[model samples]
Target: MTGNTDVVVIGGGYAGVMAANRLTQRDDVTVTLINPRPTFVERIRLQQLVGGSDDAVVDYPDVLGEAVRLVVDSVIGIDAAGRSVTLATGATVGYDYLIYAVGSGSADPGVPGAAEFAYPIASLEEAQRLRPVVDAAPTTALVTVVGAGPTGIETAAELAEKGRTVTLVCGEVLGPYLHLKGRRSVAKRLAKLGVTVLEGPDAQVTAVTRDAVQLSGGRELRSTVTIWTAGFGVPDLAARSGLSTDALGRLLTDETLTSVDDMRITAAGDSAAPSDLPFRMSCQAATRIGAHAADTVLARIAVEQPRPINLGFFGQCISLGRRAGIFQFASKDDTANRFYLGGRPGAKLKEFVCKHTLKHLADEARKPGSLTWVKDDERRESLRAKRGEAPATAERAA
Candidate 1:
């Protein structure tokens, strides 16, 4: 903790930026964040952006603290043993510790021609690419959204509200995460908006084309636009780094968020799979994970005991349109853990949550290391050092 301790975060999303901000609070840590884009694209708001909202994105300078250095580059590989990251630009970053929060992307189900024919709104770039097609098409154009997750539901509802013919196709019932009451309410909203909902007992997407989608039921749904919002798949960076990953390529980490191979490396968000927790790919988990990662790094640097993360999702939110939504309550400490809230009231709550999350992160960026929510003692009592590990000091760049 004497010399310049470099902490390189391999992503710039919510978790990555928050980690960088938190680490920079200590005088000895020099935080470096690497991301492919220059601006902070709000992944949660991509559906809103596609539905014609420009208020979702924040300028990088506006979100990252002055002490946190930003590197607009792609990460090609990681050298865990040497504690270095290789960039697509051929530059290598040496770090005393690394935080992996590269996040996940849309999964292309091996359905025939799906990847080649369907459009995905997972990222800002993808949304930008789809905007023109949406605008050029006629008002009555048929737009099909695959996957009835939050993203799909939001996109379909938003489009239908915009006076377009929107059809939502899901392998399961609409908003499978919602409670029965919430699901029924959302279905009513879809019906009111004239949006078509197709459940996949027999209509699973088998093929996608520029002009149509072929379902397993042998029905060809004519679509001028096809938006995919299915599940997510982790990036290859974890596996490429030679770290242990789950079957889905998510890096497996101890409760302390440390990678299985190297305790000095931590991971969070959709890309990280904690040994104690099941699959949860939501912003609620990402925020807490980011804070926990920062605490782990800070504790290790200070030679203090690290803490364990116990954050949970209260419930889930699915936007039916710009003005309607359903908020399901759960026991997740961070989100609402109650029944469902819907209609204008639920939409207002959902909007508040989205805005508030960004605002909190933004405020944290301005004042790094101020969050006490992620207690240090939690890490120390939960994360015990593994035996037989050598003190890693290799300096060769990746």
Candidate 2:
């Protein structure tokens, strides 16, 4: 099976980039990364893009291995049976192994009028489209940020910091993953920034309109711009290509990150669902899984046994603004703890985390096999045991 092997990585986000770069550990493996854009998007800084603090992109040469081929195009379909992928440009690339890391984007709002009226800043294009509208709006216009996730909070705070009026409508809770204390800290900062923090069950947005937003409590708030960050939706490429996927359309994979139905295909990043329990969408999880995906492919090439995912989280970081933020600590299982660092220190930490994401990719690109991460020991195993289920496994040695 081997003179030279071509590996096609379909996505250029954290996971895909990490996988492509790490795949360079073997001189005989050719890595080609396909993405819709040429530059590596720093998704974590997208909110900053809207705020005009950052553009949220890095040149591939800065973060990708020089040996990896960069294909600037979108993948339209995958032929697992034939070991190839078709791009939007009507070109097909055959691969000995495929890494499905097509990351997620904004979810269908489902709320009445949301799809047509609300702006989503999840991806680069979306953020670029939103920035101008926000800037063009009158300074007095009320900006409504829907959803209380990290993106929502960050966008609201960023806008508010820029002297734009912001209203954060939290359908359920503000920073649901944050400890109550951390949530309070964020609330305090938002209040200081003159942002209206609306939470609780009745805080749900029932509809978005050209000039206003309606809440579940029958209260309507006048708004000039509406931003949606409630949830994410992954690309339907897997399902469209006839691969088994989770309800959300992420490729169903085992703990080894290999496709459940095909050993030659593996998935990582936000588009990957391992054990049918996908990790929360974040750059942290994506990079870790990306490295593992490359490891899985390399292990197969070496005919060595690949290890299951042993990923763990340090915590969540949320930027309140350029000078204020929150770093919520979490347990190994990714549950939020009450302990958190807030204020200027938290801001510094958040900034560092964002920069470090790129640094990790650069480090991997510079030294293909140099990246290392903390591993979770027993939480997932204990959870699987309680569910009375066996971890998903895959065949090795492609």
Candidate 3:
């Protein structure tokens, strides 16, 4: 629809990078990516970083496209009416279209003293800070990990394997996303690693302190180091910018990934909530949503009818230190099934998935739009039904 279309993609995570690289498929599009860091962070391996295993970083040159411009800056405010973004560096960048992909950070622990005492390993910077704290602690010091999600399980295992006395305090059930069989497999692995698994109502953490964690039923455990991996919260940039957002601050978008408030704005990754149904925050959904966001923008520029997003789920992979893991298979809708892979083979598969995620971004950078994912027909149908739209023929990306 124009001579040169300028698209500004905020956030340099998997979603933003994929969207930026895919936008380069068209000659008329000029993509600019803005992020707080120059290097890409491997969020999936942040636990490994905290455990002193991996660095959890990738150079932008290896993942960002040559045609895409990289701006190492943080976006403070977005002027939707003026079509510009005010950066923290006091510079403003104008764009014909904006792709919101700021991703997420650690959620606030509602419990008392949690924020002040517990270390969060959600972001790369947080992981880097926690690594030193973990190393300085005595080998026999009591380390307590709060949460039973993949991050907590992995972090607890990683630390315990390093010869630290680790305890996993699952506020709720361990691996709530996993089926009973998968959950058992994980428990077995954690037991093998000498990690104390605390579950049931008594396992709920009521408060965190300087040297101990208070749990339910008047239980208190000595914790020299406490790591919080409970929940994730997105940036408030969208809501602060006067854009429509969900309760969690994720930008609200239609099924097509276009912002419901403004046609010129779209969202992807953990920062996007489409049709009030947001995908689980993971690298698997981030890449697909990022690619779909780019396609939506490209279609609008070409004056073609943009296709709605079609995404599918594979499984959930969790690493139990460097030697063991669990791969819980999921249905297309992302619910954990009974099938799972445990032990060494599971660890290898988890490692492969982490490496493959980076390789995908690199491949998309070298060849725009080279990445593709499986489609969930049921999800598309449900979304269309919710919108009162008639069923349409399926279309797959090449």
Most accurate candidate by lDDT: 3
Residue-level lDDT of model 1, residues 1-398, one tens digit each, is 56778899989988888888888778888899999998998888888777786536789887788988899999999998788999999999999999999988877678777788788887778888888888898998899999988899899998888899998998768877776777888899999999999995865888998899998889999998888888788798989878889888988988778888898899988888877343378776677688789889999988887866766456887777888988887654332333788999989988888887777677778887665443333322223323333333322231
What residue pairs are clashing in model 3?
A: none
Q: Judged by lDDT relative to the true structure, which candidate is superior, 1 or 2?
A: 2
Question: How much is 88 displaced in model 3, in angstroms?
Answer: 0.2
| lDDT of model number 1 | 0.82
lDDT of 3 by residue, 287-366 (tens): 99999999999999989888988899998999999999989999998888899999999999999999999999989999
Q: Give the TM-score comparing model 2 with the true structure, all chains together.
A: 0.96
Q: What does the lDDT read for residue 360 in candidate 3? A: 93
lDDT per model, in order? 0.82, 0.93, 0.94
Q: What is the per-residue lDDT of model 2 for residues 129-192, given as tens digits with 9 covering 90 to 100?
A: 9999998999999999998999999999999999999999998899999999999999999999
What's each prediction's TM-score? 0.90, 0.96, 0.96
**Candidate 2 lDDT for residue 356:** 90
Which residue pairs collide, candidate 2? none
- Candidate 1 segments exceeding 4 Å error: 276-279, 333-338, 372-398
Minimum summed lDDT over a 10-residue window in model 3 is located at 389-398
